[model samples]
Target: MAEQCKISAAIVAEEKSCVLKLDGYSRAKGLLKNGEFIISALFNVGGHDWAVKYYPNGIKDHADSISLFLLLESAHAKDVKAKFKFNVLNKNGEPVSSYERSDWGSREFVKKADLEESAHLRDDCLTIRCDVTVIHGKEETRVPPSDLHRQLGDLLENKDAADLTFQVGGQSFSAHRCVLAARSSVFKAELLGAMKESSAGSIEICDMEADVFKSLLHFIYTDSVPLLEIASNKGETDVVMAGHLLVAADRYNIGRLKQICEEKLCTHIDSNMVATNLSLAEQHGFSRLKEACLQFLVSPSNLEAMMASDGYEHLKSSCPSVLKELIARILPAEYKAAKDIILAI
Candidate 1:
């Protein structure tokens, strides 16, 4: 005899709620007469359209009271069963009054005189919270996680339907022209615009390393960079790669990638990398990265170490004005410390 396993499931009700604030409540009462109503903006609950109808002065015979109703806005919906609650909220957003109903019905929620005397109405405004629970006869299936980026990454790795080639630092890379164009404005212009290289079979990229170009293509296809993960394990290589990739991202007009590189460099600031990062920030007009570098240099040891680093001479040569600005930034604190010492003496 073979053993058997059993599966079980239960019906679940989907619940969703929204808050509607009625500003200028006094003005609304003056403008909207008895039996006249204003409907809240349409909202979605349980994949169906719904809205709240507010009667400033009560409808029909309940003229002295305020009325509220929930409407099913889906045109073709029939016999849709739902349990809903209406609550009037106080200034602190706690419920002051609560009422529950099933299906659909209008309630003379509160008398106008009672509302005016109550704490729920304040500053000429009123807030209502609507809670909706849609009952379903059967359990809904769970949705699977998306693998779009993985599929695209696989396509890039396989070089499937690749239509363009780039030669960078003696290594060749193959890619789909449409994908590149879609991700980068510079690529769009170079590949589809009137540029001379648009017609070329294989274009040569100068001044960029093979690995940097490879990572750039990976981001273009998958919207991610494995270099960040590598940064956690192999520190200096990924940081250097990020600097080169920042330049490439700027060249290609890829805003998001440029931001990612800037953020990575900002977080990885050190004595050896500060001068180079400052130079890059100044050259690229990256205000946030420049600010981070300046903050890092505020420490005397960090500043001293940065000046002794290999890239300091390059920074001084390429950006003499920035060095002057740095001196100006440092002098005030030094002067304050000197003045404090004099007072102590």
Candidate 2:
């Protein structure tokens, strides 16, 4: 049977607009970044000043747009530009600092920063905000589009304080409250400067390790670090080589090298990998390998399921306590729940 009923259709839409004041800007542009864009640019974003690089969407009516901010972290008089490169230029252009370049890899990062609740920070990065309508392909690409960058510049001109100081590799410097000129005396003195050699050894040949130091120096300067220098035609697992790799990674924020070490640690999470990654992870405590091991211990399944099964006995024999903890946690919660339900039934 079919029944007829009254029907009506209508489309009602309205355009939304807001003033691009500093507060409004902080609110809008804070939504754009995908977890720390070119951190080098972080010290320069935001202010009551001229326009900043923020994207306001018009396509899907506030669906998407890129926004960036400069965040500064300081501890006991040291500045850490806590921004990670998230934009295309640094992926294709020159990077400013290791910190700016230190997210490991671009595609692997997550977290579209929503600063609505945690917008306030004494050491927080600069904030940029924009609202883009969802329907436009890229509202920002349209030239002469309404924007606030000029306003950001104007505000920056009058501001007296920077976001914070910057510390990179191990050196430290003060961040300025300016538009970060494409070229600057400060950058020349800081970023493009040279390191003063302080080794007591002669510039002449010395020891086997000094040569490795020379390699580190070359890489920190040119970003062209040499591959693992196996002294012999044969390959050997030298802890010193891993140390140099870590040094190169620390100085340049080379994510591939870092991942290689991390995977090397995970693959051999054997006592050997544990011993090595423990030191490296302790040195760099913010790394995720710590969580990786923590999760691995409590993993619902065993690595045996995915790999060959010769080494479990060796692991059981070496670190029995750790092995027992791993086995206890790996047992599925479903197993216990099913056992309990069977008794109940």
TM-scores, each model vs. reference: 0.56, 0.25
Model 2's alpha-carbon lDDT is 0.34
Residue-by-residue lDDT tens digits, candidate 2, 318-344: 544544444445667767765454445
Q: lDDT (0-100) at residue 182 of candidate 2?
A: 22
* Backbone clashes in model 2: 48
Residue range 80-194, candidate 1, lDDT tens digits: 7777777676667766522222225454676677567555677888777778877677646667556677578769877999888999999999998889999999999999899
Which stretches of candidate 2 lie above 4 Å from their native place? Answer: 1-212, 221-240, 251-269, 291-345
Model 1 residue runs over 4 Å out of place are: 1-139, 333-345
The best candidate by TM-score is 1
Q: What is the lDDT of residue 326 in candidate 2?
A: 45
Q: CA lDDT of 238 in candidate 2?
A: 35
